[model samples]
Target: MDLAFTPEQQEFRAEVRSWMEAHVPKAPLKTLEGREGFDEHVAWERELASGNWGMVTWPEAYGGRGLDLIRWLIFEEEYWRAGAPLRANQNGIFLLGPTIMEYGTDEQKAKFLTPMAKGELIWAQAWSEPNAGSDMAAIRSRAVRDGDDYVISGQKTWSSRAAFADWCFGLFRTDPDSKRHKGLSFILLPLDAPGVTIRPIRQLHGETGFAEIFFDEVRVPVANRIAGEGEGWSVAMATAGFERGLMLRSPARFQAVAQRLVALYRQHADTASPDTRAAVLQAWMDAEAYALNTYHVASQVIAGAHIGAEASLNKIFWSELDRSAHRAAMSLLGATAELRTLPGGKGGGEENAWLEGYIFSLSGPIYAGSNEIQRNIIAERLLGLPR
Candidate 1:
């Protein structure tokens, strides 16, 4: 496949870069985990929606440009290069939105996609329950069919963005007697539903972005179900493919981090260890390599190649690249790495940002089904090895 960008694509990149330069916040908004920060980010999402920049690859009927994946990559590169705010509606735009488009009925698409693209409703991923963190099939949450609705009763932990998100999508046991991945259904419910409760889970950085979502006989319409009654596992695996494979964690993000790491190393090269310098260069090279592979994948996807268990490979590579790049940043920072913000009233800089990145990078191996589970999937499914 040809790797060179067409003139049209280059012009699109220029267009995106210009828009971002004019619209991205002059100063970083507050941390998105806090109530104030969440509000700020939502407003930013609205701003993006105003320009139809919320999710470029989505069709125009859903408030997108109906662009290709290659354009999405170009958009992402421009977004990161401009240091744009993190996507507040990422759970919806990146994971569930794509899944719904593929599995949802026409009515379901009309009801959910427009609002999601407009940022009028934000979504959280309720994938992990107390008993079903990495082992998703161990879910005990049950959603019983009742007339026209499903009465959901269960608890979910480590639910990202639930504290302030408008809705959540997760797997539930629709059949009481079925075990493991069988008899499960993917359901979406509003957070403010009468019997629903949300308790924020503070992270190591003392942020409340993640939450514990409890559903006590929460009644949701059967129409909220994506796919058929017992087809949730398949639908959910499709969602996970998006989360682990391409959309959720774009290679442009690491490419941006690598640029920052190189800048930091240059600032501290006079006193940095040899190992630190070596790591900085390695991070830059890896980021470029990941970006190239992402483009190649996009080309194949355009040619109708579906992302499958190979998503596990993508997840492992990007997660480790993130961790290693951040580790190198911490090494370069030394004691200053502990400071959430810079000293001597220096204001927010790489010193402050590196600490946050370093802390978040630690979780890369754990989220999105965890690197361990991913490896098992690669070995058993991709490599065709015995379980």
Candidate 2:
């Protein structure tokens, strides 16, 4: 693989770096999990749209710059380097946006993608159910056909961004008799629709970024369904691939954390143990390795190779790397890692960010299919192990 960028790629990176430096918030915004923080981030999304940088890989017709995955990686690198706020519409731009592009009708794309890019609508994932856990094939939520609409009745738990987002997309059992991964349909619905109830779940960190959605005979138009009935398993597998592979968690995200971790170690280096220093170096190297591997994956994707069970490998490595890097940061902070409040009890930015990240990192091994589950996939599919 060619590790060197061409002059044009370098120029594009410079353009992105300049724009991000000029427009990124000088002071960090609040966490996008809170209502105020979520609003602040939505506004940032609109600002990005103004510059036509919302989703650079998307076609220009859909509020994007008509770029490719390589350009998207560059954009993410500069974005984190600029210390930009976390995206409030990640569900829209990353996971659902690509799925919509593949399975949605042109009318659906026209109605959804542009507003999604413009930040007119934010999205949540409604895939996980209380009983189903990580096994999405075990989904039991029902969407029964009724004339021109489908009546949804069930519960979805651990819905990211559903606490304040505008819309959601997930799988539902369209045929009541259908079992496992079969007879499901991918459906979209507004959070404020009638008979819809959202109960926010506060995490251990005291943030209500997730919610449980209860749908009681909620009627949504038939047009909200993506792909054909009973084909949701296939569509959702594609979405899962995105979530597990390159799209959802970019390498630059971890690279930025590694940069911060290095600085953090230096700050407390005098008293730091040699082990901590070694761990820090390992984390940094892991971040760089992830970046190079991602570039390789992007090249293959551009050449028409689809991510498969191999995505499970990517999921395990990055998630564990995230936790390891943040663990090193927490070690550097020691007891003060918990000192998020300033003199007046106001939250501090840099100090607070590390603690917050460490807390968030703890969940990495669990979400987007748990590392344990990913291991099973690797064993059965990749390693040809007997299940």
Candidate 3:
């Protein structure tokens, strides 16, 4: 396949780059994990939405540009290149929005999609329970039908963005007697609903990036359910593919990080060790590989092909590359890397950002299905090995 961009695609890239250059915040916005930071990120999301950049891949009726996958990738590249704020509503836009488009009713889409694109409803993923992390089939959360509503009761831990999110999408056991992945329902819940509690879990960097959510007879309308009962496993698997394969961890992010790594290496080349320099080069190469792979996959998607176990391979590749790149950055920073504060009062600069990224990178191997489970998927499904 030809890797070169067509003239039209190149023009599209230029448009994205120019827009981001003009609109990206002059100073980095606060981290989205803190209370104040979450609000700031939300405002930034609104800013992006105002420019119709919030969900370029969504249909125009849903407040998007109705762009194709290739343009979407270009937008992401410019987004990261601009060093824009982290997406405060990524759970809604990346994972849930596409799933809704696929499985939700027209009413559901009309109600959720527009607000989601406008950053009016930030979403969290409540997929993991205390007993269910990698093995999501072990989730014990129950959603019992009560007339026109379902009363949900259970706990979900490690829920990203739950601390300040307005909504959550998750799977629950709808059929009491069914086992494993069967009889499950994908459902959406308002975080402000009665009997719902969110407790923020501080991360290594002392930020509430994840939370534990408890539901005690939380009443949700049947209309909130995404697909039919017992079909959640399939819907959720598709969402997971988006999470692991493309949307959640885009290649543009790594390319930007890799570029920053190279700059950092150049700044310290005289003092840097040979191994660190080599690692920096490797990071750049890995980032380029990921970008190429993503473009190839995007081409296939455009051709109406399904992405399956290959999502697992994508996840493992990017997650490890992220960890390695951050490690090299930390190594290069040496003693200053550990400092959360610089001499000035500034909370986040290049040094602190890398430190924060390193902490967050530690979770890449765990969330969106653990690397262990992903490796198992590669071995059993992709390689056709025995389970």
Per-residue lDDT over 1-387 for candidate 1, one digit per residue giving the tens place of the 0 to 100 score: 566889999999999999999999888887787788889999999999988898999999999999999999999999999999888999999999999999999999999999999999999989889989888999999999999999999999999899999999999999999999999999999999999999999998888989999999999999999999989999999999999988988889999999999999989999999989999999999999888888888888999999899899889999999999999999998988887767576653333877787888889899988999999999999899999
TM-score of 3: 0.98
Clashes counted in candidate 2 amount to 0
Report how far residue 8 has shifted in candidate 1, in Å. Answer: 0.7
TM-score, every prediction: 0.98, 0.97, 0.98
Candidate 2 stretches greater than 4 Å from native: 342-351
lDDT of 3 at 130: 98
Worst 10 residues of 2 by lDDT: 342-351
Q: Which ten residues in a row have the lowest lDDT in candidate 3?
A: 342-351
Candidate 2 collision pairs: none
Error of 1 at 357 (Å): 0.7
